[model samples]
Target: MSVRSGDKKTKILNPITIEKDFGGPIGAAFLTIFLPLTTIFLHLCCNEKYLAQGLSLEFNKVKDLFYDEVIVNFKENFFNERIWLVYCSWFFILVFLDFILPGKHLKGVELRDGTKLSYKINGLAMMGLLASTLIARFIQTNGEMPELSFIYDNILSLLCTSIFFSILLSCFVYICSYLPLMMSKNGINTNERILAAGGNSGNVIFDWFMGRELNPRILTWDIKLYCELRPGMLLWLLINISCLHKHYIETGGKLNQSLLLVNLLQGFYIVDGVLNEEGCLSMIDITTDGFGFMLAFGDLTWVPFTYSLQSRYLVLNPIQIGWLNFSLIILLNILGYYVFHSSNSQKANFRKDPASFNQMKSIKTKTGTLLLCDGWWKLSQHINYFGDWIMSWSWCLPTGFNTPLTYFYVIYFGFLLLHRQKRDEDKCRKKYGESWKEYERKVPYKIIPYIY
Candidate 1:
């Protein structure tokens, strides 16, 4: 019931209440199959060869989804050992950086046992070192980048590798969750293993999909936190940069404005994510959700592959943008970034030291937590989501209106943010009860101002 930490004992909550999320077992099963297939389908749909043969969402072009050349290429390249080696090497390098990197060890939110886990905040440094190594290699080769297009060429294989790794990791952690506490000698504290509230449904499929262990770790290396940012986020930026280089080489050193915008905006987003990595410690993924198949696949495969679709799209369809359009998109992203960053900072600061935000109005709940009600929080319950959605458009708008496929990121991100907001509201309502209702009364809009 309690664990000793320092001079005091911390009480641990018991029998975490099981709550069926994502429509329970059937939905989990559906998503487990549907998501990966969707990623593959989207990749095929956006394939250069398929697009060259008039790939569109039209009924007649639907058959193009099964284009012979594309299918053959994917099948042939799906199991490239070289690609797998590069992907695995990248992962292990990140792990090495995580272990050896010097950083401020920030304590994460207290767990059910009322003990905090220390996390190394060195993502920015890691990014810098990786970028420096890459740049040094580029300089050494006189800017003759090592077949950067190989990434684009072997993308399918890379994706398969990530998906396989995610599945393998999920299985490993799930099995380890069943190990005895004596396994702590091997650096796993099975006694501290707790089933996720939404994942302990007694159904293996759903549990695996949703993640069985709440905080599966090896010694001090928190697997969930490490994966959340290191591999996927960095890989996303790397892919975007590689796409830019691919475009450069293919276009004979001519830079596409649209591609540049996509790279710059997304680069900024990724850089910000890495620099402010500590902000994610309190997010739902790290604080609540288990490191399951959903997160594993999302972090490894979905994020790097799907989120970089615009950059990948522009590699084949390099659309030119006017100065007017470019300026507007930049302004839009700046606005979005401002709101997203400031609001998050306010919330984080408020959570850490509510008294520091004395000027900002907040509603105190019976649960002894303060819900911010002023500043950006007054505009919407999830103003950060609104900002994030706004920025998603900037990433897509540069691809032009030639095909709806390029806009998939914005569309999918919008839905994902909306779902996340709804989930957050539901959880807060259940946690705070009438106080949440009061907070809602003070801040009516869910995400957008004067809108939904």
Candidate 2:
């Protein structure tokens, strides 16, 4: 292992570590229910579906609403077996493509246990396939595009299927993680188990939520990595496309300008992520976060259903996008993408060859070394986070200054990134000690350049 500089402290909680940041089992239980419920409710808010006409939120009728409205509505609208079969078929085909498609077999960053995992680089090819499939299907229908609208129409059932499958997949992850240990003739060094890097935390609810295995797998396939990219991202684009189709059909082929901007920006982002698929190796999700329910659900359901909320809303709401406003949003996304790509590339290049980043210097710790503050990293501990923020809001903005709902993604993302920044800082402080403190002093801002 290459020696890297660090200081003192406790590190971030591993997923398999029995730490209760969400309060405890009760809290996790609530989240387990709440997150999926919120996923449904948000879709409800965007679509305003299944609500009785003239019904309102009232404290006096809160209990009645819970029993009659929430429970009954969810029960009825939740799952449709036909939709489930179709969606699952779509998903497995993507998996088949991921397996069959060829690309570089890249190695990931070394793990705490010294394992360097491998992942396939077929995302870009899969993305091309996704586009081609959609085009071919639509063209076959003579551009009527009902299949596209089918998703927008039956979104609730689709969400149910994704969430169900995510939970099922997490169960599979938990089981697979322990198979090696249970099967071993010798009392297995549990730590050396295949794909279960960090092992189980022993709390089922927490394990299910946070993930038990560090990098779960199936035969030769990298389950976590494949999930991290394939289904949700292409599904996100597909949902946006469906929204576009719905808009076109509604307005006699006139596209909603706001919807167009949202698609272009998010479409660009997804395509970039796929094309730069190899970079997933060094991402926090790949390196650290476990393959559990939190991620499984998020990658499959939350991402596809919630992340495209604005696009979904715009389909129903159809907001105006003026030329000036569109120009501003375009600029914001461009700037954000530029900073995000440039800052990440800068750090990645420095890691590969510090000499390439001429301004980089080394700080020697008692054991080894760490990179000196330079470029965007010098500006802020997580400068690219700000860039990411800019891009997120720009996508949200075309919804205009109407409902607070449209702005939710930006608001949620800001808080999420802030939590991530602190997590990274804590991890660095534990690893780098006083040197991390010094670097923190040098890079005072946590994300934004002047204002954190």
Candidate 3:
């Protein structure tokens, strides 16, 4: 990767010399093993059968990790053909929708080579079409919904299938990144296949985990962007709905308040994401990160399975929240959303057109980029992250502290956001130098207001 500085282009060499993030190669290898296992472990702990057995999420139960029955069950159900077919079909359907859907063709940020990639802004439309189809099916069935409960019933198998495919996709992209570029009649442009910064560490395990290509594309279809929102995020909503449907059926047409809230809140988040799909183009994942195992596993498997933990927990252990608590949770989410949305909007707007924020207090970086010192940006350097963390708490709060497992999302998300914030800070410190220190001094806090 190369950064354009004035008329000079600074070239970054392949195979980064020094490695630190993700604990270098050894840490990457450990995570490669640990992340998938963690996902599977969480699923096993929170599954209907395990919860029905009156087991607590205590450390003593760790011994059951290698129980004969558990191992046998996993081995038997881990590779179901039906589940694989369903998973693959859903993925392909999303791909097909991405191709045929109509929306504005927005251009992405210019690359080092001054090339702009066009992306379709049809995620919301695709979501609507899918929802309409599902609704139609429900209507056609005379008010009887399709077997969405199947998703919950076969959750383990689905997770396994997704993991398998994530690894497969990661391998495919990693190998493709190394292949020599084919020369076009117009001549070869090496910039068309740029490696991700820090992705080429000369360690296969680390590189594979971190991702090789900055933006791996097959023709015009961006694999990373497609995976970012389409399959994993939409599937998360689908899983919540499935769990909700299961609860509804098992309770004889009654819905649990906590389950309902989880569904509504998470569904809203997913809808908001789909509607604002264009915003993803500027996110760190799309602009900076490579398409590798870290992202693939997170997008394909970890998100849908682990994010729906609260709903999954409520399925077997329904927790009833009082109206007062429910209203408080809703209010909390509203506040969080306000902070998240407004802060992100301010930053995006400033990035797109700094002139619009001329009246806003700002500091210009050495690279000619302006940082706002007013509005939400004034509160904290990563005020948006604070908002996002707040919302994550609301998602888990409805679970009512029965098991620490249910609260995993909030805790894990807090750490994840902190790690991401640190990454952004490091990158900014390097890019902006003393200007970043000035921005930090002005903002004071990193994520929370009046706190560290």
Q: Pick the candidate with the highest TM-score.
A: 3
Q: Could you tell me the lDDT of residue 26 within candidate 1?
A: 91
lDDT for each of the candidates? Answer: 0.82, 0.76, 0.83
Q: Which candidate is the best by lDDT?
A: 3
Sort order, lDDT high to low? 3, 1, 2
Candidate 1, 367: how far from true, in Å?
A: 1.3
Candidate 1: regions farther than 4 A off? 1-17, 52-55, 58-78, 182-190
Residue pairs clashing, model 2 = 5-369, 6-431, 6-432, 7-431, 7-432, 7-433, 8-433, 211-292
Report clashes for each candidate as comma-separated counts: 0, 8, 0
TM-score of every candidate: 0.92, 0.88, 0.94
Runs in model 3 deviating more than 4 A are 1-10, 13-17, 52-60, 65-70, 183-192
For candidate 2, write residues 73-160 as lDDT tens digits.
Answer: 6554556667877888888988888888878888888655344667789776777777887789878987777778788888877887
Instruction: Kindly report the root-mean-square deviation of model 2 from the true structure over all alpha carbons.
Output: 4.8
